[model samples]
Target: MNQLNVSEFIATSDFRRFHFLLLIIGFFCVIFDGYDTAVFGAILPSMMKEWHLTAVEAGALGSYSLFGMLFGAFTFGVLADRYGRKRMVAVTVILFSLFTALGGIAPGPKVFGFFRFMAGLGLGGILPNAIALLTDYSPKKTRTTITAIVFCGYCLGGMLSPFIGILAIGNYGWRIVLWVGALPLIFLPLAYRYMPESSFILLREGRREELLAVLARINPARKIDAEVRLYEEHDVSTRVPLAGLFGEGRALSTVMFTAAIFFHLILGYGLINWLPKLMLEAGFSMNSSLMFLIVLQCGAIVGTVVMGYAGDHYSLKRILVGMYLLGSVTMVLFALNRNATLAYVLIAVAGVPVVGAMNLVQVYISQFYPAFVRSTAMGFSSSVGRVGGMLGPLLAGWLVDMSFSIHSMFFAFAIPGVLSAISISAVQHRYSTDRSRKGQAEVGMRLAGEVEK
Candidate 1:
């Protein structure tokens, strides 16, 4: 492939526009991901009644999608590391958008489940790659905040789903909602045309010219010093085996982070998957239940923005743990409430902390690993968490079928939230110490090099 020309890349307006443009693209991609993921839940009752499906079968549809996400997160994550972040992101979006659109034409639950699985694959792949892409280009000081902003797109998309369901599904059908899920395809072409490959990838590949071009695009105002070429390390390999995450010094942190993710996703997905049904059981009308879900997601959007800012200024660990703990408490309150206003308030409060912590978890994971292994770490953690996500709905379905009160289900999910908060708190303490050591090591290396010179 021909290398990008640094001078030409810097001179164009496209270079100056690239960062914000990529952020916009990332935002839209995540929005679609949220829409497609939540569609099944939003219209599950309609689908069940129309298809004469059992609760177990309807629950399988959700699990199948998450199963696909498990595979997609690992497979595409490795692909992003070996190939490139931009390419994989483009491929994932196209795959998801196409499959999501295909879901509109399913003849039965099985077929719908299959298409949703495929869409989940695309959904799974997009998130890690998108996080990696944003982190690669973002300024170090603002990395976590930028990631939180991108994650807010998911909440924003979720908040819009109930409105879409009430307006479109009521008028047309659930099929219209499925078809609208494909609207994300509009962003695929834009991603292909404008999204640049990550500078870190180019640096690892020893493509100095390409790295310079990407840097120029990211910051056109800064003049590149002639002697300050991209650091070329020939020993760097992008191919990181999944097993490497647990090898030697990396094992404990890896396992802890994975466990934290598992609990976080379990609570997050469980609540999201069952919130509407829970509301209905709590005596809300169908419209009221759906409206409450929308309010919950709106709280999530606001919480993500606030927590993102907080995560940057304070410790990510403190913010994440606090949120999860608050979520657990609010969930209990939500389950006990019967008053309409109180129920809505509790549910919205529960949603606020849950999603904000989820956003921080993504940001923290991305920061924990180095660039070459970053996507792989993201994939592994996400894949493990997806297992919990898959189980959440299935377990809830089983509990509901057993005639357990909705309050019991909420209490069960709350246990995972408490555990996850503890895990994150521990990991945070470790990461703080490790970061300090690494900083000292870097200073020592610099000092030794200067003395030798």
Candidate 2:
């Protein structure tokens, strides 16, 4: 009687064509996610002028979508765990893509804000599912690296925002740029057709035929007897109640993780949402200000790659602690430097730590909790972190309305860096759900024996 444990098989699976395909799927999803988030920032200047909206009003509009995201994370993040990751991901992509297109054609600010809020729900839902999906299948040795590479597409999409704003708005106005949000609908069919459903969900439901199909695709060369049985190694811990997130010596780290994410996002959303407007106020042309966002995202791409590699090699916790502190310095320099040329360079440098911190932390959270609760953990943190995401823009608008100096604008941005550093510094690493290297190595060995039965 041949038997296979799904966890052991996935942990030991080689990185092959199948894994690379999955990487492409994850990368494209993140790119659209980035594009959707950065779109508001890119269009804000144009939208403000055309709509004659005040900074405070514009900021409130921005928070509407983030508010929807807060709920989406709380709702879909948990639903994915129950309904199926692929299905929930598909549903989210549709919700955001179709509604954002509606937002583009809206005649008034109120309607646009309404549509965007609807899109935000889908936008917010994608991350937990994407992170959960990638982590479930990626080789343990390369998991962090792979996740970083995929999520960096967020910055890649951000890099395109300014260029799209320049071209689309110049030709067809802001609505054209927004209309582009629906392009993901075209990408959906291909993904739905190729992407495999989560094995854990399948196993829990006892979907034998589907599991067999996925197992064959995951390891095409490995022989599987027609009657091979599938099972999970029973662990008392895996069966624990969801409350285990706060129990089992994990309560402190949970709070710290939520706090770190909150502070990081305050810096992240505040910067992305307001950078162009702040630059315009600082006396640059609209085009020049938009270009700064490109530099920032390019810097983010560089940061994402570097941090992912570094975190894989060093302690992710320690690296994050240092990165937040460095972000404070970069943000301050970027804010005070009036020279457009120098500002571009400084802002780009700022994106590395600020944007990179966002990607790496999501990767960390996906790893921090066990698979049973992984999606819920990510959802809860994001749902809470989104409060910062929601308030960052609103607060920035208030600062602008108060007529704070550009330097003060970023100085507000910087204080959170220290707070974030303090928060992440407190997380206890001994409780991380990630398996140790030696244990993972043993899982790899066990695969060979199990396949021969």
Candidate 3:
């Protein structure tokens, strides 16, 4: 009898408590990641006032964290693939949480930037591994949806940050908000206790007993007879996973998606990092600016769920293309609006297509690669996007320094979405062609097998 593949088992198994527990735990991990990342934007106004910094300096500060994230995504992603995913998750959570708190206590802008950069490293490290763990466990039928649910933590954290800033900044100051980010450290023990090692990794390392033990816990009702063999479908003996992304006819898809992710992140980080300050400049009060941020996140929550559902049922590539096109329109409208209520509405709408689509990029990328290279692919792609993430806020600041009008700045941001839409369209064509070829090859194999029989 052929050995049972772990992925096959995952696809065939009924949804169980173990599956739901994994999603909940993954949600908690991403929540703090979102919170710490967004809090900087929320508290930037206060930082500017306290330090008397210019827009360029503030933008550069935002880039500092993203630069760390770029490094972390590539470095930690490789490490997780080599060593394991479970311990990396726990360590990153602790590292980011501690440094985020230290950021609150830093006496100067440079020191604060250093702490933020360190926290970025942790924040960057969590995502690809978290998604990899979730992918290893989820059924293929629901992989995209499960990822979206896990990512909702990001929107939730982003939503909560502005509110926290509003309440904490008013009462205790911006530092208090940073100090609150340290709360994730309290959950570190839970991460260690609950998170399981990847069965795929276990099997690859010849740890059969350990792999069987995890699989059994995953479905306690099922008994594993001695006759049962366990395995995966592909050979991953090529020690370097990153090379596989360039092989297996994946190079073009990888490059196209990387470019798409890069541009999408530019729009995402740019808007989130600078929105409050831009609103303040537009004459909104501190409380109101934070409220705009809240509204934006609320829209993001809605958009994320909607996109997740759509991706599951419809063509993900087409849906993403439509979203980017819509985002272009929304950004322009957001720039032109002046009425307070209407501006709120426009910003909220902007969040749906812009922030919403940005969330979907990871889900789309995850689906593009095979299991062995999934984490590495996610890490490298996200690392590329982090380059955009770093450039975005810095560009916003530089544009501000150059005294560019807000309208022109937003228009510049919108241009990337158009390019992203075109690139994804090309990707869709390539993917369709690949699938057709796969179908033909499978048909040929089936015929040959029948003849032999």
Candidate 4:
């Protein structure tokens, strides 16, 4: 049988209609993730007032969902590696949507926190798998771009949440605002019908016939058949996917990347959760605060696209490092600036790296590991970042509780951004050094072989 590496087949294939369809399905899933997560921020004022929650209590309430996300990202990631991406994707969507609708009925803080936690589990599961599936389908020439495009769904959903809040939360109530999160159910059937199983998983299972058929559909001209045996770049014999992440001279890089994610997320989720409230405290009206969120998301969309394009052409690590540094500067500026027009402009700049960098990390981690462990690595990195995600809101709220100056609160948050930049730069330097050494070894071997001949 002719050996056909499914990863190679996919990485070399031309972009097709099927590819577009895959992007759409993953896109919508990300949108729901964005909307569900951001809605909490949008309606926080209303929810806090109704429940009479202290700032610390409100921060704790937000952390409950982030905690859920931490568990969900890790759990579902491992499950996706074991069970298959399609099933986990479907399961997570249903799980989060169900819990989101249930959130509307929550009578008090504990119950509300419970429902948010449940929904957070689903939120945690969706992104990594979505990125993994999309990565498997995409060509290398444009993989980063496609991943960013799909992630833009998240930015769109986040951008829309405030508008929904303006229209629905103001008139109806915060409960009604959360009820809309259930709307993803309408798209669930479409996702199930259209989403394909990960081709790499099929290859690993030695499902030749199925793999061939999938390959053919991805590119009809390839004429894949029974004679073809699917191959993969990663050794399938590496039975433990999680161990593989820490093996292969990858331990240090993995730890550094995870640390980078942790710091960046603290900055990212902290801003996302509190930006509206921070603006309100800064003397902007409620409506203006929501508008600032919209602008931030809008900037996020542009930043995601810009960074994706840059990543494809330049050093991905350098791009991230620069973005993180810029993010730190922008956060400091965002807090100090009181002029409405200037603050909007500063927050928009902040959004480019603060929010957009998270999307970059998704694409970055996907490229870092092989298909066998892609989801696991993504899940682990994101789950680690969830530590920051969980702490970010709580820290911000605590500062508010303690009456820390707003500008200084942001200055403290900026420290993580600086640390994130340093962490990513270290990874980049290691990667570059390794590549150089490998290149030198290859040249040495080639020269010796020539002399021997």
List, in order, the clash count of every candidate structure. Answer: 0, 0, 0, 0
Q: By summed lDDT, which 10 consecutive residues of candidate 1 come out lowest?
A: 444-453
**Model 2 residue 281 lDDT?**
92
- Taken over the whole model, the C-alpha lDDT of each candidate is 0.75, 0.83, 0.80, 0.82
TM-score against truth, every candidate: 0.90, 0.93, 0.93, 0.93
lDDT of 2 by residue, 1-453 (tens): 777777668878888888899999989988888888888999999999999999999999999889889989868877877677899889888988888789788999999999989999998899889888988888777888899999899899887777799778877898888888899999899998988887777776667788778878788998778778776432212243246468657899888988988888888988899988998998988888898889889988888888898877888898888889999998778667767688878887888778988888888888877665677778888888899998899999999999999988887898888999999999997878764434545676332211221
**Candidate 3 has which clashing residue pairs, if any?**
none
Best by lDDT: 2
Query: What value does the lDDT take at residue 335 in candidate 1?
Result: 70
Per-residue error for 424 in candidate 1, Å, reads: 1.2
How would you encode candidate 4's per-residue C-alpha lDDT over 1-453 as one tens digit per residue?
Answer: 355556667888888988999999999999989988888889888888899989899999999889989989988998888778999999899878889889899999899899999999999999989999899889878899999998999998898788888888777887887888898899899779878888766655656566566777789986755554455655554366789678666777788888998998788777788878887888888888988888988988999999998888887888888989999999888667767789888888888888898899788878877677888989998898899998889988999889887788888878999999888877734433223344544565321100000
> Local error of candidate 4 at 198, Å?
1.0
TM-score of model number 3:
0.93
lDDT of 3: 0.80
Model 2 vs. true fold: TM: 0.93
- Under the 3 Å rule for N, CA and C atoms, how many clashes does model 1 have? 0
TM-score-sorted candidate list, best first: 4, 3, 2, 1
- Select the stronger candidate by lDDT from 2 and 4: 2
Error of 1 at 183 (Å): 1.6
- For candidate 4, the lDDT comes to 0.82
